[model samples]
Target: MAMTAAPPRVVATEAALALIARLLARHGPLMFHQSGGCCDGSSPMCYARGELLLGEQDVYLGDIGGQPFHIGAAQYEYWKHTQIIIDAVPGRGGMFSLEGPEGMRFHSRSRLFDDAEWAALVAQQPACFQADQKL
Candidate 1:
């Protein structure tokens, strides 16, 4: 039997994709970091590649629209069981995010992973979650 690919931990909606395309055309390359609350209120902040410094505390969730997406390690511990859905919403984005001037923000929505998806993800990256022992 052929092995199926695991579902992505992060994904973007069509509007978010279109916005990312626009940002890419103007900015060259982009990246996303899901804010861990506080001033940013958990919004997904978009930046030009290399704009923000990522340290060991950041976990690379996956890519959306070819841009890498990451979340803080502590936040990931809470969010690991859910699929992160990136959406474009009408609003001023995080003060530091590129989308602020565009009148749209990258928002995060999520749904808990069903048992099958959770199993596949665990099987695919057993080492990554070993510390949590979520299995």
Candidate 2:
């Protein structure tokens, strides 16, 4: 048999996707981009409402804590080699983290913090926040 490799699939289930759709439905469009960051040339960031660089691109959907969200196409395109999946654990909520196919890692977006997960997410992204629900 010819051997090959498949890219990582979202770990979340259908229910999660449904939830994400609901959460994002009211929050406006899910946007993504590459920005200069501490570790390297750039990092992936998500916005609840804003103009997207690419108006038409495939968006990734995944759910966390019964809330749905999106990952922008441009962001995925840049980091496809790194596993791109929503970390939908309960307390962790839903956030994007880069798990290198090897070992190193990085993250962006708000940690899937329900009314409780806020503290840690804040610590990680103190200045990056959404005021009036506009991130």
Candidate 3:
């Protein structure tokens, strides 16, 4: 049987949540994208909702601290076994992210999901696909 209480593949730290709340107050709704490309590498980039254009190749991983997070499908395949953890650090953010002006940047931290967690996530895949709620 499938797991009924699957954990999200992505989450945020308390500090990250606090920062996200502040950004929301100033920018309204927001979203994040972790691109496995050049320049920022795999850093999480924050944007006010609708500011960034998502391509067909993008995959929505899930929400973190209530903000939707996405990644390239190719990247998702590489990261599928890990849980993404968003955190805040004092620095300039991605040049275009909303937080760049706030002197705080969003960072990506990850760890491989434990065996049980991985199994539960895999079990939830069918439900996730049926939802078709990619943001």
Candidate 4:
């Protein structure tokens, strides 16, 4: 039997996509980094592409609304078993995020992958799963 591809590790809700489109129109290309810090740092921060300096410990999870999404490697270790869903809500966004002034904030929701999904993900990206094994 042919093996199907694993599902994406990240996705955006329609509300989040709408906000992203608006941000893109004003800021050009964009990117997202899930903060591992306290308070606002736990939220997803959106920035103009290349605005944030990525370190060696950042892991690229996937894309949402055509923008790349990433998280700290340490954070990724704690979240590798779940799928990240980006949603937009009424609130002040992360202080550094572009959406703060727009009266909406980006939020992260997650669900754990099932056994088959986890197996497929591991089969599809052995290297990534292998690194998690070391944690």
Top-TM-score structure, candidate number: 1
- Candidate 3 lDDT over residue span 34-122, tens digit each: 97878776789998898989999889989877889999899987887888999999999887778888889999989988777766666
Pairs that collide in candidate 2 are 19-68, 20-68, 20-69, 93-112, 94-112
Question: So what's the TM-score on candidate 1?
Answer: 0.92
Model 3 misplaced regions, further than 4 Å: 1-4, 127-135
44-89: candidate 1 lDDT, tens digit per residue: 9999999999999999999999999999999998899999999999
Clashing pairs in 1: none
Instruction: Write candidate 2's Cα lDDT for 5-34 as tens digits.
Output: 322223334543444455456565444344
Candidate 4 lDDT over 1-135, as tens digits, reads: 666578899999999999999999999999999999886868999999999999999999999999999999989988898999999999999888999999999999999987777767888775855555321
List clashing residue pairs in candidate 3. Answer: none
List TM-score per model, in order. 0.92, 0.30, 0.86, 0.91
lDDT of 2 at 72: 54
Q: Residue 37, candidate 3: how far off, in angstroms? A: 2.1
Clashes of 4: 0
Clashes of each: 0, 5, 0, 0
Each model's lDDT comes to 0.91, 0.38, 0.84, 0.91
